[model samples]
Target: MNGPALFYDKAAFRKAGLQPPATWKELRQAAAKPTGGRSYGLALSAVATEEGSWQYVPFLGSGGDLEQLDSAESVSALTYWTSLLHDGSA
Candidate 1:
């Protein structure tokens, strides 16, 4: 059987003219906005499975360093992720 929709609020989103963010920076900014405590900026599947790997692909791809995960670009990407977590966006 097919799984439930991974995303919620499709109808509301349609009304709001919402579109998927084109860049990580845009996503981060959106998530950081205050929405009267009724909205979340971001959420990712951290479950120990393929979903986790999928969630991480953006950072890895942006960094362009698979062999050296600790490269400067990687660190920057990780820092961005940490900021989302700290800001309660992720």
Candidate 2:
């Protein structure tokens, strides 16, 4: 119900010479910053139902089609989702 906002550790980003990611791809890239051996770039919840689907909307909007789940768009969306989880970027 609220709008999107970036809640980052500003000091850390500043020390690392980084900025808030402006897009999904930027987010993916930003999520790769080295934590000097102990932290992740991002975190997310993983529950079933509306919350889970809500988390997917961005990717779906980035490249997906509800009417044709098998289309390249949908596949790209799904792939991004899987990669995020697999790579621990979300």
Candidate 3:
């Protein structure tokens, strides 16, 4: 089945001296570490369409609910995404 997944370059991680991230915070930190020279730490689908929304489901699923779009968890998820962009991690 098609799904959201993360792909990493083992060599890149080794070169950056990073272990695979185990948590959202870790992922955020790691995302910036290997970013440079036309490389990005994470690539997200931000297009305004179903494909874009699909790419976000997994992240939101971790702490947010579509049913409660205004809930704290939802806000947090969005905030996290914003942080990633702001920090040049995505």
Candidate 4:
């Protein structure tokens, strides 16, 4: 089956001279670059408890379990997201 897709702004990518990220690592690399001084590099929403949980699903899934968040995969996923915030990318 096909997975979900992230539709990026073609104009922003062109202005940034960046190609769409083919992997999570590539996304991390580009997440810190602003798009033409107009929009943020990335946008995330975790407004409240429910929404936060919903938004966290992907990161939790990357680690494999909702209960065991101490797993290496879980840590990696959280750390990656934290980096985005810390690096001012999101």
Candidate 5:
């Protein structure tokens, strides 16, 4: 199926002593590290526009359907994204 895919530099990951992330939590943890001095773990489009919301579709989907935006799954997904921002990982 078509979906979001993660692309990372092997050399960089090796240098950082990190393996490929296998889960969302793991990805978030990995993203939290090596972020400093203009370095970011992930590149996210948070602009206030349709494109910005489009970029977050995968994350929202992980939470569940759009019919229930306030569902637990949806909240969890949003919380995850917010954490990434708060931790300066994106």
Candidate 6:
């Protein structure tokens, strides 16, 4: 599949003073913020659908060696996902 449109609501983001995060750590930390009376940081698509796989792209991309799915980086990605679930963030 091609993917969803890569558009950003610049006006809304500008109104919120949102800047592009420089690192993955920053992104995760930002996501962990409590807002709108919600406890979780971000929303994840766990449904067995195209969106679910799409949502997981970052982890897969971060694996460094896509040819080796069982690489340490891939394992780390899975671990992070599990951690999010255990901590009620996923």
Q: Write the per-residue lDDT of candidate 5 for residues 1-90, one digit (tens) a residue.
A: 335567897877888888999889889878877788799888887789876777777888675666887899988888888888888998
Q: What lDDT is obtained when candidate 4 is compared to the true structure?
A: 0.71
User: Could you tell me every candidate's TM-score relative to the true structure?
Assistant: 0.66, 0.74, 0.89, 0.78, 0.85, 0.60
Tens digits of per-residue lDDT for model 6, 1-90: 534332334554465465545666655554444323545555666879876766666666565444666789877777776676666644
How many clashing pairs does model 2 include? 0
lDDT for residue 87 in candidate 2, whole number 0-100: 80
Task: Please list the C-alpha lDDT of all candidates, in the order they appear.
Answer: 0.65, 0.72, 0.85, 0.71, 0.81, 0.58
Tell me how candidate 6 scores on lDDT. 0.58
At residue 66, what lDDT does model 6 achieve? 46
- Return the top candidate by lDDT: 3
Candidate 4 runs further than 4 Å off: 1-5, 35-38
Per-residue lDDT for 24-89 in model 2, tens only? 787778777733345777765567877656666656776687678899999998887778767866
User: Relative to the unseen true structure, what is the C-alpha lDDT of residue 64 in candidate 1, on a scale of 0 to 100?
Assistant: 52
Worst 10 residues of 5 by lDDT: 1-10
Error in Å for residue 5 of model 4: 5.4
**What is the lDDT, from 0 to 100, of the residue 27 in candidate 1?**
69
Across 65-88, the per-residue lDDT of candidate 4 in tens digits comes to: 667777888888888878887777
Give lDDT tens digits, candidate 1, residues 3-90.
3223535654455456655677766765565323656756776879876655765676685565787789878877887888877776
Ranking by lDDT: 3, 5, 2, 4, 1, 6
Instruction: Please count the clashing residue pairs in each candidate, in the order shown.
Output: 1, 0, 0, 0, 0, 0
List where candidate 1 sits over 4 angstroms from the true fold: 1-19, 34-38, 49-51
Report the alpha-carbon TM-score of model 2 versus the true structure: 0.74
The deviation in Å at residue 33 for candidate 6 is 2.1
